[model samples]
Target: MSRLILRCFAVATLLVPVSAFAQFDIEREPINYLKGPVSDPISRLQMRLDEAEVRLTFDLKSGYLESVLKTLNVSETSQMLVFSKTSFQRNRINPRTPRAIYFNDDVYIGWCVNGDVVEVTAVDPQLGGVFYSLDQEEVDRPKFARHTDTCTLCHASSVTQGVPGHLVRSVFPDSVGNPILSTTTYRTTYQSPLKQRWGGWYVSGTHGQQRHMGNMIAKSSREPEAFDVDAGANVTDLSKLINVEPYLAPHSDIVAFLVFEHQAPAHNALTLANYQAKLALRDEEILRKMDKDPDAPRTESIQRRLDHSADLVLKHFLFVEEAPLTDRVQGVSGFAEQFAARGPHDKQGRSLRDFDLQTRIFRYPCSYLIYSAAFDGLPSELKAIVWQKLHNVLTGVDQSSTYQHLSAEDRLAILEILRDTKQNLPASWRK
Candidate 1:
């Protein structure tokens, strides 16, 4: 039920935070995401493109899209189709010409047929979500539209925790891909239920006996319950729903969509964690100038705030509150198998990225996003707490029911994998 409150200013756009939850003045604040000396991988690529170190060719049917995916380390199998007229280029998007989104571990690419530009969102270690765009027309020289304030319109709202980040939304839409704004919109995360997902999008998958808001155009005046959801179940192809031609692949993989659902907010949560930690520590320095102690002798609040933020990030990293899949959820796309094959495993070849479609998102109750730059870029103090907490939970020292969802074998395997593969963990973790 999380939705961004968007409004159009004369020319500049604003990410209007939810008024009910009053917090920081995110709009006016100097977001470090935009304040980088600009050294993220995506930014570096942008520099290369601008300096003619790299050149991109425009293709007639987006052949460049396929090549670009390969270049970005994004997979072709990671495609998901959305037909919502809710993007910046709403005038160009429709159910008949849905936008195709693709992603891998840290990057997301968005494409629309006949659209003016291609969108890119990448995670930056120190800066959080870094957004850019490439013109989709005939061009000899290609440059990314990097760090524009307008993109923060939708990306940097309460939806993204007041930081420039990404989000996936589900909404009731009419025939034209225009969301039925009178109805409630859903900003999806891993915690979202299956029933309330995938509206305004075309999903091709098989979820046995489960119903969702996908594959149907909502009536302008009707409630969500009015549609026959069973009619949309088990859809493996999209030719019937729309002209699947003019797109890279005809399939809008459901497994990839589910993975996107889980990762988008997971990345945002990590970004928020990093941002919060940085600010807290920065404020602590100001306290030091005031001759106030951040510790108990000076101020007990410093440790408390840092601990709270770290705990929230830890909860998200471990998926402590992920919604259970009631039915045997399976996607017809080979994506599940393909995605599983690329994991970094333990001595026994198990990974946190392994999917458990029958119950929840993953076999081990840990997010692969923990390995992302955003998680790694957390203030060392906060990251230290996270690493220690992760070690405790994995080693059965902190076996609360919140994490009890993980089996003893799962924990042991995750511990072994992290200890062996993940560097800079607490030394006691290996012991």
Candidate 2:
């Protein structure tokens, strides 16, 4: 009977589940997934920015600002928060503390305030996201507001009716928004530290008052040539009035909003380009997905193609700095030497010279510089994608042969590819 009981106990032990054997036993401590060094404030700020859904359109990390900061040797201590009434204004006021009073559009009255930042218990009129700082620190306000009267007098005539915001006039066939061309109205009035009439978009003009030289008499409505002055005194050339290109009031309100209000980096041509590229890619992706559905009916393929073409054109504009590889060398011999040094080996263990007699062609350094520079300004996410694309090209894993060849036709093809590729990218890339 004892032997039988022992056999039963052994059977029960063998039948017990593995989980039951470990029952009541303490589990090993979880791996510290969040372990490591604490991140710095700037890194924290970047993470917050990502959380806030701020699309850093340009590569902010290695951008022109970084270069400028390096050249100036301007430390963080040297940075000062300043508010200038106008781009032409020489005086800049410290927003942290105020000594005098200024016009307040909200109350329609000028009052002397102790500081630039005012606590508003009342509801915000715009961007009703609560008038508070993210860091729980005091909210510093710019001296000027976007809805100010001085700003509206000139910008009101803008394409957006004085919105003083980015004028998204029309989406090109490729889905990129072409910035509303600055008209005579914008040039005549609206002054800002940035707003230039030339260089397509994003003010490339020097920040200053426009100097109007004179008017052509032949183009004038009134005949100033026949006008005479007092006895023996010459009449000032009526045809040549020194009319300054209307010092259109600077959109200080917009500038202030971009800089202090949003705490965004200063708007530049590069930023504008990045914004356009993102928009274009978005449009292309939507169209491509729509085209793929056979059940959706044979809808506007022509329109889609047109849009694709337009995107290609815009990409060309964005990549205008990339020169053709062929243009780099004076002759074929110099090109060959450079090509041999770069080593374009094929899968068949053959060099570029073995496959093509014209292996002497050199790659354009300027093109590489432009491509690399563009990647530098992109946000971290997009920068990673750009880096990946570049890596593929360098490894010959990607068909960037058209871009490498440097022919006009190849350039256009590469532009199209770039547009399509950008469109297919995830939305996270833009952010």
- Off-target runs (Cα >4 Å) in candidate 2 are 1-298, 305-431
lDDT of 1 by residue, 142-248 (tens): 66778557887778876777777897889988888898888888988888888899998889987788777888887645674478888887898889888978887
Candidate 1 lDDT for residue 181:
83
Error of 2 at 180 (Å): 20
Please name the candidate that would achieve the greatest TM-score relative to the true structure: 1
In the range 1-431, model 2's lDDT, one tens digit per residue, is 67557545544543443223221111111111112122222233335555763322212222222222232232221121112121112122222111111111111111111222221111111111011111211222212122323322332223322222222111101102112223221221111211211111111111123211111111111332221112111112211222212111111111111112111111112232333334334443544454554344322432332333333322332233232122111211122233233333333332322212122212221122122223344434334444444434433455543334345443443333333333343343333
Model 1 stretches with alpha carbons more than 4 Å out:
1-31, 50-53, 292-298
Candidate 1 has an lDDT of: 0.75
Weakest lDDT window of 10 consecutive positions for candidate 2:
168-177
Q: Pick the candidate with the highest lDDT.
A: 1
Model 1: how far is 431 from its true place, Å?
0.9
Model 2 Cα RMSD, Å?
22.8
Residue 85, model 2, lDDT: 22
* Number of backbone-clashing residue pairs for each candidate, in the order shown: 0, 14
